[model samples]
Target: MHVLVTGAARGIGAAVVAACRAKQHRVTACDIDASALAGVYAEREGVDCVALDVADAGSWDSVLAEVWARQPVDALINVAGVLRAGVTGELDPADVALQLNVNVRGVIYGTDAAARLMRGRGSGHIVNIGSTSCLFAVPGNGVYSASKHAVRGFTIAAAGDLRSHGLNVSLVCPGAVKTDMLEQQRGDDRAALTFEGKRALDASEVADVIVDHVLVKKPLETYLPGGDQWKGKLCTVLPEVFLSSVEKSREKGIRNFKSPQH
Candidate 1:
């Protein structure tokens, strides 16, 4: 299979690329940081490193055109995203736009572009990297949560629409992962909820599920750690009842953030 993964320079995206290559699948690794992408995968056979800004429609067009010219992409994983932590009342307009553009719009653009080509091919898979935040509200990362909610909603609808075209769309929602993104949230009290997870997931752990399971089974939605799904669902259905627990989790997260072990 030929796979294209955005945000392939680091974190879960990079892990996915490595996992795919380990399976001997052809991969096109894309990232906004072209230099870093090239440094990471340029010398590796069976991996094509491309510079991509997922928020820009034109960039998507160009990247897909070049990729298709070489080989048909069998799977597209939309892993490119951004998060800006701010409470609702003090939110920065720039942060809101950046999060929405990169997280929500980026996923939409990639999914649309890939689905168009896949529709013509008569079969393909689209996997979107979502967040646990989509299931409930995160006080500090409201915009990021909203963006992920948009992704989850859009992925589900897109799965329904693309099924008739013989294409599959899947959304993977994971809790806190030990990545640069999580590290960025460590010091911010507003981002305390993000650290509530007992332990952060390794990027490879999530990638294993994507490549070993999601790509093979093509499930419409999957939650990393499995337990998080039920927790998120319960919170969603009865947020008022869970308010106290949420506060407790936030307190725990703050402690986790401050601990050297975290």
Candidate 2:
């Protein structure tokens, strides 16, 4: 199988590349930062590094053309995304737009492009990387959560649209993973205060699910450590109680965060 993975230079994307390779799948690792990709896969066999800005439709064309010229992609993993954290009263429109551009629009375009190629081939897979934010709202980082919500909706619609065409679209929603993006969230007080010092699943663990379960045995959606998503759902059932507990937990966590000894 030949796979093209966006955001492949680092974090979950880079880890997925390794997971795919471990299974002996031919992979084209792509990212906007070509240098970062080169650093990892310089002259590596069976792995192609290509520069792609998933937000740009034209860039998708060029990269897909390049990919098609070499190997008709068997799976397109949409992983490129951004997050901007702030509460509603203090929202930055620019940050929101940037996150929407990369996270929401990028996945939409990537899925469309992959569909075109796969529909003609008669069979293919479209795997999207979503977040636990798709299940519940993150207090400080509402925009990021909103974008993931859009991702979940779009993926479900995509599955319906492509079902008759022999294309399988699946969504993998993972809880906060230990990645650069997670670290960045820690830098913002509004968000970090809510989720700081929380150890998360490893990127490779999520990638393994992508390779082993999603691409191999396609499920409409698989939430990593499924219990996390169930917990998220339970919050929606009783928002007042859930939020009150969350606030109490947050206050406790903050106190512990500020003074380690006591």
Candidate 3:
């Protein structure tokens, strides 16, 4: 299969690229950081590296066109996202825009572009990387959570809309991951709730689920830890109660964030 992955410079995106390559899939690895992307995959065989800003619709158009011209893409994984931690009332306007642009709009643009091409071919898979935050709103990361909520809704709708055209659209919502993003949350009170998980997931663990299960099963929605789905569902069904409980847990999460274990 020919796969195109955004945010391939590091974290889960990079792990997904490696996982796909291990399965012998031809991959086009893309990231906003061209130099970093090149440093990681330029020397690797069966992988083509490209620079892309997933937030720009025009960039998606041109990038997908160029890639398709060389080889039809059998799969597209939209993993590029940004998180800016702050209370909603105090968040920088620029930070809010950045999160909405890169996380929500980026996923929409990439999925729409890829679906068009895949529709014509009559078969393809599109995966969007979401977060457990999509299920429950986090205090300091409200905007990021909202963005993933949009992604979750969009991917599910897209799955139904595209299934008739032989396209599979999936949303993978993982809990806090041990990436640079997680590291950035350290020492930030606003992001304390993000550290509440017992243990952060390795990027490869999320990547493995995508490559091994999502791609094969083509499920519309998947939660990385499996247990998170129930937690998310419970939170949604009892937001008032859950919010209070979650608030109480924030201190523990903060301790986890500062602890050596994290």
Clashing pairs in 2: none
| TM-scores of the candidates in the order shown | 0.97, 0.92, 0.98
Candidate 1 TM-score, C-alpha based: 0.97
lDDT of 1 by residue, 1-262 (tens): 9999999999999999999999999999999999999888868999999999999998999999999999999999999988889997999999999999999999999999999889997999999999998797888898999999899999999999999999999999988887899999987999998988778888999999999999999998899879989988998899886676878888899889866545
| Model 3 agreement with the true structure over 139-190: per-residue lDDT tens digits | 8899999999999999999999999999999999999898999999988888
Cα distance off (Å), candidate 1, residue 197:
1.5
Q: How many backbone clashes does candidate 3 have?
A: 0
| Candidate 2 vs. true structure, TM-score | 0.92
In candidate 3, the residue pairs with backbone N, CA or C atoms under 3 Å apart (3 or more residues apart, or in different chains) clash, namely none
Selected candidate, larger TM-score, 1 vs 2: 1
Best by TM-score: 3
**Per-residue lDDT over 1-262 for candidate 2, one digit per residue giving the tens place of the 0 to 100 score:** 9999999999999999999999999999999999999999998888999999999998998889889988899999999988877889888889989999999999999999889888997899999999888877777778998899899999999999999999999999987677888767653556643353244678999999999989989999899778867777787677776667766655654554344221
- Which of the two candidates, 1 or 2, achieves a greater lDDT against the reference? 1
Error of 2 at 112 (Å): 0.4
